[model samples]
Target: MATDIPSPDARPARSGRRSGDSTTRTDILVAARTLFGENGFTKTSMRAIAAEAGVDVALVSYHFGNKRGLFSAVMEIPGDPVLRVTTAAAGPREDLGRRLITTFITLWENDDTGVALRAMLRSAVNDEGAATAFGDFASGAMMPAIATTTGLSTETVRAIGSCIFGLAVMRYLIRAEAFTALTTDDVIEQFGPRLQAIVDADT
Candidate 1:
């Protein structure tokens, strides 16, 4: 009978594979975000991101499809717009305005979400695709959700989107003096009721 002994340095292949996969994906995202911030999206390519991540270029495509998908991943908005809107909708219909505003505020204040949001917004001004992407998500996903929740018409939903977008612009984008002077609670208390009235007025 012959006995075989494994080498001392040998380890489980599966565990090593799992660790590498996790680390690689995270590295790609970090690299992409850094480069996107420094050079903007169009200037950054898969190869650049791959080099920064110390991985093969194919791996970028494997994980994130293309720059658009990768940028979307980097944005990492919490629960996605659809999920967030649906969640806000689940609460009291009468409370939908306040809940939705609070939800938007929370998304805007969180570190990761807020950073990506501001980046996307800033880029959108010069980049049509970015503008369309953000606009579509806001108008397409969120508007309908609010309309459905409050039983409001399409026009009313646009009004709701306008208000929320303006709020984000004032607080996150421009940091307007008049809006910045007020606290989050103050904005919520003052503006929230007016939003509620829009929903309430719809038949």
Candidate 2:
């Protein structure tokens, strides 16, 4: 007679609360929030969070996928920023700047993504750790990807990122009437070509 096999869910439950438990997840989040605020995103290591939570480092990955994922959780960011920006960069070289400007403007206007983005920007402006994390994400990952796609130097791409960053700060953070009063298309029409100029600097 063939023996009956146990289904995956029917298997014996683990004895402890450490195995994918809600309490464990809460511990990690609490630890991550404290560290991320105190040390900033770039400076706070996953290992430190794991240690602080009294859990294995792998649990951090299991719970959040990676450092950025963990940061997104701690910061309540809705999605992967690198993926979003790089995806926007994908297209013909001529419109790279336009696409980027459009992307940032769209992100700013959206309710779900915009609030988290503005919060992060506010934190970055005031906190050194948050600033470094933003710089690294832009200069290290996002800028390099845009540079490769557009044949522009990372410095040039970074300049464009800075311009958009300033736009965000002015429009949202400072609530400057000049920037806030303009329609999305107005902002894009004015700034797009200026960003494109940096892209075309070498040409």
Candidate 3:
């Protein structure tokens, strides 16, 4: 048998995959943070993050659930939008809207989580990629979770999601004087019924 020989310009083939170990998680986070900082959340793809981390693309999803989840992890968002929204839906149907509004206010008013969330919203307003990513997260994950928990139609859940998203922009991001002047209770009182109407109408 002839011995195999490498060509002069050939190099050793290498696999970028890292062993699935405790450090793998940390590696992905580090990679994600670096890429996110360089390219921003909208520009950074899950595959790019995985390649940067030398891990499989599926590994990123395995740890963070999806692109938005990975972004939340990299940004150190206190709690995820999905978790917060789903938690709000855990109560009685009549109270769902109020609970949702309350949860949104509590989260957006927090020092740490609020800052990160504000950044995300501002980015979406200014960047097309970020807007697309935000829309995907809201429609793909957030609305589905709410629809499942509340037994609402997709259309109804989407309407509620849209309402909540607009709430964030007006009250926090835009700082519309009218909206910002209202106290949290005022917001819940006024907006809760709007969401309730959507849910109630879905019959």
Best model per TM-score = 2
lDDT of 3: 0.75
- Give per-residue CA lDDT, model 3, range 1-203, as digits (tens): 01112223222223667768788889888876765555555456777777777777678889988776786776556667778788889879887888888888888887877888888888778866556656665666678888898899999888887788888888888789999999978988998888888878988
Where's the lowest-lDDT run of ten residues in candidate 2?
1-10
Model 1 clash tally, residue pairs? 0
lDDT of every model, 2 decimals? 0.68, 0.74, 0.75
Q: Put down candidate 1 lDDT per residue, 1-203, tens digits, no spaces.
A: 01012223222222222224668889889877766555555455667677667776677778877665676776554335665667776777788789878877777777867787777667766665556555555565567766776677999888887888888787777989998888878878878898888888777
TM-score of each prediction: 0.62, 0.78, 0.73
Candidate 3 residue runs with Cα over 4 Å from true position: 1-49, 56-68, 74-76
Per-residue lDDT over 13-124 for candidate 2, one digit per residue giving the tens place of the 0 to 100 score: 2334264666888888887776665655545667777766777667888988887777777666677776777788778878877899999899889988888888988887
- lDDT agreement of model 2 with the native: 0.74
Give the distance in Å from residue 110's predicted Cα in candidate 2 to where it truly belongs.
0.5
The true-structure Cα RMSD of candidate 2 reads 9.5
